[model samples]
Target: MKIIVTYDVKQILTEESRASYLDEWQKEHASLLRECDHLQFEMKRLQKKRPSDQKWIADQFDKEIRTRSERMSFLDFKMDQLDQLTLGAEIHDGEIQSIQEVQMGDEWHGREQKGKIVVKDGIVQSIVPDSKGKDIMI
Candidate 1:
């Protein structure tokens, strides 16, 4: 029997474009690496001369390091979020026009293993296995 699979092709395209933009922005901001390196070097230098360093100097170093680290972390988080959203597009393009049937031990979007894809309202509803079935309703 053919299985129903639903998905928003447009949404997938939009996500793909967003991911590309984010990736481009990350590449353009490659200077972040240099800034991180500089901050690390400065911190090490100050640490070695801690005895002669002023309190304000250490505080400023800490602040700068924290800010830089947070920015990097935020960017990483955004990238990961986009990746998850666009995972469907990564599997296959176009659309699942036919009732795509899946067998056991089959992989969907590089996922663990086998199941039948269930689509509803032009979106993925669930992926249930023929034997040990589980609805991935979303």
Candidate 2:
């Protein structure tokens, strides 16, 4: 006979961990939110100038404004997802307790494509290839 046992685990976040995550989230979210707000304001400003501007210029501005608005909406959706993840992490105290392995996919930005330094306890342990496929040894 095969049997499996499971135990409930309580995840607790240390003050440092909580602060780190909260600060990181706030910094990123605020930047994106600010950009979205700016894009929205620019769109409105452009719309107001439409009637007085040259036809070609007006059309171009309108197209750009619409594009910006669409991008802003997408950013808003991303921010909402981040908010949900933050809430979940807080509830779990940042402790991922489940033993199940999961495959995760991520997009790598240019900055992350280069090698990155991993620092733990204020000490640099090693330099590793970032989220990209390149490998770097420290």
Candidate 3:
């Protein structure tokens, strides 16, 4: 059986791209968090003031608070996506290394008894024995 080796070059590149994305995300997240904290402090200070003195101010504060909340949520989602991409990249890199080692035609007889090779998500899944004399799987 002919084994199909799957490697997602796009995914690898996308994964590598996450470092920059993550850095930007982190900076934005920190800024948002700081803004939220400042907003909360201001809100508290406003709450202590005379309501009649700051008429209609609550609406503006509410809008700013909501906008900050939405920004935080979006940043959280972006961070999650970045984390997943980073993890996928690491897994794929490991798989690529494994495939390279296996394909190097090393002395498998003495080093490793027998193993089957399976590739998934741009990496090797497993290596099993071919008891029935079948073709090697990549």
lDDT of 3 by residue, 1-138 (tens): 223333322233244456656787789888988887888788768867856745466677778978988998998896786676534352222322123234454434523333234444445444444323343444
State model 3's lDDT.
0.56
Question: What is the full ranking by lDDT, best candidate first?
Answer: 1, 3, 2
Q: Give the TM-score of candidate 2.
A: 0.33
Q: What is the clash count for each candidate, in the order shown? A: 1, 0, 3
Off by over 4 Å in 1: 1-16, 28-30, 46-51, 86-138
Ranking of all candidate structures by their TM-score, best first: 3, 1, 2
For model 1, the run of ten residues with the poorest summed lDDT: 89-98
lDDT of 2 by residue, 19-58 (tens): 5655766666666666656766765676677756656555
Candidate 2: regions farther than 4 A off:
1-18, 52-118, 126-138
Top candidate when judged by lDDT against the true structure:
1
TM-score to true structure, per model: 0.42, 0.33, 0.45
User: By lDDT, is 1 or 3 better?
Assistant: 1
Model 3 poorest ten-residue lDDT run: 90-99
User: Any idea what lDDT model 2 has?
Assistant: 0.47
Provide the overall lDDT of each model, using Cα atoms, as 2-decimal numbers: 0.58, 0.47, 0.56
